[model samples]
Target: MASESSSSSSSSPASPASSSSFLTEPSPPHSPSLDATTSSNIDIPVLISGAGPTGLMAGLLLAKMGIRSRIIERDMAPTPDSRAVGTHARTIEILKLTDKAVYEEVGSQSWRSESMRFYFGNSLVADIKPKPSNDSEFHVPWMLAQTETVKILTDAYEKTGMGKVERGWELLDTKVVEQEQEQVEHQQAEDGTTQDVKTTTRTTSWVETTMRRAIEGTNKRKGESVVLGTVDMAGEDEDKDYEVKVVRSEYLIASDGGRSTVRHRLNIPFPGRTRDYNFILFDGHVETDLSTSHITFINGDNRHSVGMFPIRDNRVRMMLDDGTLTQEQFNAREPKTPTKEYFEKLLEETLGTLKLKVLSYNWLTYYRVNERRAAEFTHKRRIFLAGDSAHCHSPAGGQGMNTGLQDSYNLAWKIALVLNGTAPQSLLDSYNEERIPIADEIIKFSAKTLDNGVYQGWLSSNMKRMMLSIVPFLVRYLPNGRSRPPFSMLGLRYHENSVNKAHKSQHYPVTGPASIGQRAPDDILVPFTAPADTSVPRSEYLAELEEDLTDQPIPTRLYELLAFPGVFHILVFAADRLAKEKDFDCCLVKDVDHYQRIWSSRWPGLRGVLESNATSEAMMCKKMKSTPQFMVHVISSATPSSFESDPNETTTTALADREAGFGKVYIDCEGGRLHERYGFAGVSTKKAGGGIVVLRPDTHIGFRVSNVESAAWVEVDEYFGSILVN
Candidate 1:
């Protein structure tokens, strides 16, 4: 990382330059001679604006791509407050891709546990259980304070060795000067004689050069280069060829927190309402009998919710709502001033007299639930907004910091592409298309969550009162099932316009939210195969295949076997091989044979496609015949219940028998439900070759195809073609 001294002299802003006058005619002037030496000295691109996280991230991406950028920050010193804390799995994955060691060190050591509890007055209601894992669609949520997250990211940025964040420099104004093209004018030309000649004539002309610039400044910081001279905008030397003036960049990303200056300047409307509930958060040391756990959310009569988690060693962080104290009161409360008696009282009121003591208080902050999102995340070509700058909501979901970091993650790659001249500028439009719907959904879900937490009293409390009044027996028997709403961080899915096509569906039947294009879940996948080989099992083969593809070894193959490139997959296992063969063209026997021959011929290439160790005797035989570029496996058997370890054991008997040879047979196994789990309900049992299965790359089903001959290949070809880049 580039380290510079904080001591540096300040530079004054230059005078405002005249704006380009394109709408009016240019004044006639004498052309001045330009010197080649001065003209050649100008840099094509240079520093232009503030050096906040957004700008710095952009600069880092650009630098990685070998582009030059200078970042200027208005802040004299970096703030130490823990503004945002949460980091999403996606962001972690992205950062891991960039710098594995740094990402792991920062992410792994952050938070320890998470749990949620409910309360009704002084009584404990119930502790909420995390949603059961359906598949590897989501992972457990992790928490980290915001200040630490920023420090890590900033450190990574400085380490890139491209540009340094020139703090204390602010953007004052911008003007366009000598743009590539100004305007084109067309006019009618006069004829020799008005009545004698009736010939039409035309003339075209170009407008003069446009120039613009404004003034800004930078504060002195130790150990940094500082310019002492005042930059004068009006004092332009005539020898310069290209107009030398400061101009706005092609794009501006507003990651300036919730109170975004860029969003305000753009006049964008933030649409949403703030909730009345307030929260108090503190970072400090505490000791208690309760061993460290995931997260503790205590909700009861005092109507308070506290989240306590380990940060480092004995240091812990806690978030709780003291309903009695307003934002002002909470802010005014001094650290270490609140006595142990006061903390005990607060805990008794909030957590039903929990036995815990506060050793030290580091930081205390008050926050209100403000659920708001901008109507538009982008404006024109000049400005784009993200993170708290674009959306804000209750910290209950812990989405504030996570969402912002993801915003930068999503936008950074796109910006890098545009700046590097790889992707067209139009690609930027997809940012809004993909992210807006997500923000809107989060807002809706958060609102519902808040409502559920705050409004359940009317019915539950009254019922409890009535039950207690009638008989204590009935009241005691009634299940105390009040639990926190399912706030799994993994629950959030980018079903719409997500690059992952497999997770496009609303939900995954087997694993709940394992939609198409969503992240595959981590699970212990049991494997089954026909013609079971004692040497290698189906699970081993699938595991190898996954490892070969991703490099990272997955413990289980949670996704379907057949997946389209960049799409989801839905694998269907038929009970019998004849039934599977029947789904092909039985009527067109020749065509079926020819296609089978072709598949057999291409089976060898399939070896390359297998993830890892996904080789079986049957697969080996298939590979011997021909290598397919990509092929998924499925076992078929007839005896639904009798079929156990090996399906191929009875394959000879089934295929030789006349009735069972061409008929469909149901197979009973734990894995048989895999089809139903993935929403493959409409199978055509009447005809042998009538059932069709659809697949997405991430192993989610998009749609199924049935009763088709060569059309299946066509569909597969088309789907893969759209996603894979060769």
Candidate 2:
């Protein structure tokens, strides 16, 4: 009840418990900054509907990219219930870039649980912890309530001047106000001639968004004053609270929940079933006989199917079946929000002698699980759907809120780039192409887990029962695949995606461990100290360094290099000292210069600017600023000693780091494990080694130049050339 987490479990356990275990986390800094934008000036670059995790996260991320967005919530405030509870690894990685405190706050307040125990009444059925620690930053998954997460995200978002959630607003109507199509304007001759002149004008497409104040009397309007109360001045029961405003924007994002008004208005079909099987979920103080550290699923052959977790403040979160409630009893609870008594009696009877007393209930919900997905995610490339609007499913794996946040993430960068005029408009289309299949996968996965009552279906309880007897045996031979990278979503791929250029000669197989389209793993790096020079500003030299990171076996992490302003990250994993020296002499030195020469010097016409005879330093610097900025992280297998020893090596590395804008140099000299992990199998001097890996702003790999040669740089040039204007 105190924390927020979208809870997920690895085992189905003949029960769909949605319970989350959490430690008491410190509350967010006490409203350090109040929301400044109280005016109803909804005119912004991006307007986000539904201020849930998806919308809040979208607004925050867009702000990081210097894009301002107005997030509108139909409700007056954040959700009181613990909606989602599990913060997976990839999500934690993403949050660390935005604000490390969120990651730390969420992690501290939640229990890190790997295995969940299942019992049939008092009898033990299976104790299963399918996933194990791998390359993830956090070894085990952290569990915080979803509400706490919302507060952290919301506070962090509000702190950014970009936008804040206008809690009293709701989407009333949306339409294509303008379309980017040619229109012919006909004008009669001034002399009244028989012929008329015509001019063709091209109009850029945009959406006209109309939103009304759903909640009464809490909005500050900018332009015209509308009715402020539910009752009008006449008191004739007219809907006086309906204050509507129509604003136009280049794009609109619908992060609205399952019954998304934006999705409905766009005519996107959401096809799925609302299962008859209903469940009662409640969070309250429970005196129970269970471990306080882990999630337990008390389940079995349709007898006592329940899930219990120890949450913050000595309270517990529990979920169980509807327990044969009559249709009359079910319908009695108006709005489907359950009563406290409905859950107390059920918990008492189910626990029997286990001693579970629900002293007080914080929130109660009766939900009929539904698995559905929108047929498409975007409309006319102007209006986009995300979060529950795009895809919704039974909360089996806690993928709902997490996936929604990810949807906002995947689309945010593309929108930023396209709007920045660096990327082609077609880049926006990849959001649908990539996310739909992922939604489909989760929907199928959720259905099987929800119907775990009898074990006949996939993820059959029977299979778990049999596997339980030999779990230790299974763990030995099995790759521990279930709870590993794939389960945590760190292994998600978009290699077959149109936006990715990974199938070329140099790029490794997308299926490889750290290949194209996969979440780039975090690796440790040792800092190389340059010669003490009072002239060089050390803090500003490694200026891109993040403020939040603390102690470690190494100084910085690979993921930290990623959380910058929205753009591509080109990591040139140069080989060892001698090899890098050779590689630098061969071509690494000219990579940035080549792009600069092509984009700035020769191709000024690409930017639609007239060729200038004025080529001063300031003029060239201004011209260079216009091109797409891709951060270059040159990670080498060499140690600081190498650069300290060789003058040529020092000069090359320094030139790349400072003069050429190749990012900070990081060392991974410990057997080059990071190099090997990224599919650069070996990078010794004798070996024909090293390659280039390109990562998107969202940290997904886009392409790789595996063949690290002088000529191989052209492939990279071609990759950016296709999508970027210059």
Candidate 3:
């Protein structure tokens, strides 16, 4: 479905001879000219007007939901340019829900190293590692060309067979007309009952057409289909259906881009100011022999900055200089100051005269950095905007493409729901309410990065050099304050909603309101019963547990019990009651002694501190000393049966029984009457029996536990408790 090949050089216009074919196709199955009553019977639920990554992804998700969509694109074929090149961990997790193969394939092609070194004039100032912590769930950022990413998405979309993208079709206009009934006279029958006669009324129609010449290779002109229009945008009351005039579906999305035609038609202001900065993007095959595998940023001169990211096999992507340039200057036929020459000078100035050679060129483009946010992303209830249409900011953190793709992903599902009449129109309001704030935040963050100037100054150059020399030591030992930006895809969350509000205040720390929808960090090793019956060795317990708990769900009751509003949960496991008893009996110690030792050691000063302040002593003690007791009560679904004699033996037997009945209980608990009310699903498998699972309000697991003494467990709890309470 997605194949890469050499780009064709031909750029011919459509020929007139092909006009007849465009006009002669069979009438659409449900044309606008048909009677409104008859047309209502056909099921054409969704119509998308773009086939880029966002549109394709939305279509793919719709297909997964068993819904059908038609995508119309103005492009005659897919673009070969490799635009946005970074994929965050959060996107990978979202994709995993519908297409694991695509996730795995894309993940296998990510950049794993931590730091990105910048060489500036006689100095190396900033050694930036976007996310430096090894404890993060998404430890690496992926760098793949936008073209390739779209190719993968297209392949996945086609496999669904529930949708098809029609290239070359464009949207024209939309009009709405109410269906009316004809007046008739009433006649009295013999029984004195009035009989009404029915008559046909005029039906209003919304016509949509596509120009055959607009998409053809030759200058051929022909008008295409006139079909009924679906809701392009909905007003506050979605129940009241309206028609939109679509002249060309292919170009419909252009109105959503920054320079929106629809906005112009409606006389709406875009309402954002553009910053005074420009960025030049160059994509080409280079002849450089630099052996370094990591991305290189050259920052020395205050006037310009250079960033080089590895694309596919041999090609690389480079962004240089900032600020706007005229079209003539950008596309000079003679190429007096080429990108290669610019990079060479930058490398020499920053790295102190390093030998680098230039090879061939592929594509070159320039963009002015515009830090603007739309006043509102929707208008008049008939038009909605997403991606660049809603917000545009500097590409400093490589967030532009990822952010746009995610925007489309969020909108597609809601659109499908509205189209299918499953969700109320109010759901649509959440889009702007949720995403506009994020866009503002992104713009602010990008502005900060721009202000840093470390990516283009002498101080930054020196700092980068020094950091690169000491990175090995810094990464191994002092990794606390020296981490990268927390720009995880999973870090994004929808907090201003009822569903998220129900979560306890301290349930998901690293991934609460601040990090909702983010992938839970991989650092906290989770110990779960191995799905297979093979005996787990003590030495391999933590390692195997980490592997088993990688993507498991956090238990729902955990969030309920913590009772924190829109916060994260940190669960600490103390010594297993049965194991502590065994140790006590073997050493002839009292139960209280064992409890004190386990509580003091695992939870340490936290208990004493809480006890000193009477306000929290009971809760602290319960969390530290009596967790197992609380666990017994919460794990009621396991229906754990305890025996006083040989506590370890009894606990082990009960665990086995719970595992045996796991599937049924999990289904009933997560899907039965109880699960529906609570909105909590059991962890997918029964393997979660003998551990503590930190759950988010959304029921996603953030961390898990088996042994109480593990440092990871302690860290998880501390992290969970440290989240900001909002």
TM-score of each: 0.56, 0.78, 0.59
What are the per-residue Cα lDDT tens digits for candidate 1 across 1-726? 111112211232222333222223322212211210011212222232444444554554444444455555556556555544455454554444344444666667666344334445535444444333333333345566655665565666677665666564444333222322222345444654333333332211111112222123222223321201122334433322221233223445566556554555456888776555655656666787544454554554555556665565555666665554454564476662344555557666765656557777666555567788988887653356777778877765566666665566556555544443333445466578767877877777767655544424557645643443444233335432111123443444444342334322223443343344334332333333233444655345434433433233332243322221111232324434333343332433333334434533432221212122122221222222222333333323233223223423433223221111112122322333333333333343444333334443223343444333455545544444443322
Q: Pick the candidate with the highest lDDT.
A: 2
Q: How well is each residue in 289-357 modelled by candidate 2, as lDDT tens digits?
A: 666556677653435467766567666677777654454565575755667776666666666555666
- Writing each residue's lDDT as its tens digit, candidate 3 over 410-485 gives 6654544434333334555666677787788777877776655434456764554566667655555654323534
Root-mean-square deviation of Cα positions for candidate 3 versus the true structure, in angstroms: 15.6
Between candidates 2 and 3, the one scoring higher on lDDT is 2
* Residue 209, candidate 1: C-alpha displacement in angstroms: 21
Compared with the true structure, model 2 gives a TM-score of 0.78
lDDT of 1: 0.43
Q: What is the lDDT, from 0 to 100, of the residue 269 in candidate 2? A: 88
Poorest 10 consecutive residues of model 3 by lDDT? Answer: 606-615
Q: Cα lDDT of all candidates, in order?
A: 0.43, 0.62, 0.44
lDDT for 475 (candidate 3): 55
Global lDDT for candidate 3? 0.44
